[model samples]
Target: MCSGIRTNLHFPTCWDGKNLDSPDHQSHIAYPTAGPATFDTDGGACPSTHPVKIPQLMFEVVWDTTQFNDKNLWPEDGSQPFVFSMGDTTGYGQHGDYVFGWQGTALQTAMDNACFGATCKGLTTQTTATANKCSVPKTVNENEDGWITKLPGTEA
Candidate 1:
């Protein structure tokens, strides 16, 4: 059986320098450009519309399918047996949202110093155990685990 699947996500880094967000939640930001010379690389510049360039946010996720490695566990027709929590079976529909949570200029200061991970001068760092102790009041009152009829916040 195959090991697993890994996906890389690169969030838009160019901001409109006006609105922090839009009705569709995407109009105010865009990916950087290299002007057709070559695919946008590390040195790519933001477009005129979104003149303010921000630090890029990237994520890497690894899905574990080892428990279902047995051929008998798969569908008889040989279709993929995985479906994302958002009901995306095609995989292409996978997406994520972001909300700025850094306190004050914490993020901006760190970015300016080229800090990677938790090495910024003024930024604070905590162990995984300490961070795990943090929690917030549940705003969405719903069953978030086990089998469910549909994903939360997705109404027809």
Candidate 2:
């Protein structure tokens, strides 16, 4: 009920599903249409040729205004990027170095209790990293800034 600022993210409509990531990265997937915009997720297949229909991945990132304001975070200059990205070749095409580190409680509780939507309510903070099959170094990205100094809850 206390969600503040927010943003919406929509993944590519078509997916190859074979590569977790690609080198050139552009050739492995495709979008069959072009327009000002029309995201057709009407339970349709990818294409007649390569049939892989992925359930649309929609991400709505809800942020707390108290901590996420432009001044507290980063202000808009004429050319300063409000955000920095390491991956995604097709996006801003900003291929460069990025800092990777944990910012909050232990990596264990984050791995075990991470959820998408309504399930994330009434959560507790943990203070240690528990390394197991569920808690690997590479799995940390799934945590998605879990170290931030705020709890995760968005208006549904």
Q: Point to the candidate with the largest lDDT.
A: 1
Q: For model 1, how does the per-residue alpha-carbon lDDT over 20-109 read when each residue is reduced to its tens digit?
A: 789999999887785312224643888999888777676656776787788877779987677777678777765667777889998888
| Overall lDDT per candidate, in order of appearance | 0.73, 0.42
Q: List the candidate 1 regions with Cα displacement exceeding 4 Å.
A: 34-43, 85-87, 125-156
RMSD of each: 5.5, 14.3
List residue ranges in candidate 2 displaced over 4 A. Answer: 1-3, 16-21, 32-51, 66-156
Per-residue error at 97 for model 2, in Å? 15
C-alpha RMSD (angstroms) for model 1: 5.5
The residue-by-residue lDDT of candidate 2 on 1-156, one tens digit each, is: 223644455454555767645697545554544411134433344654334544344544445544443453443553322232432324344323223354564334444565332344335433323322243357444655423433235233
lDDT of 1 at 23: 100
Give me the overall lDDT of model 2: 0.42
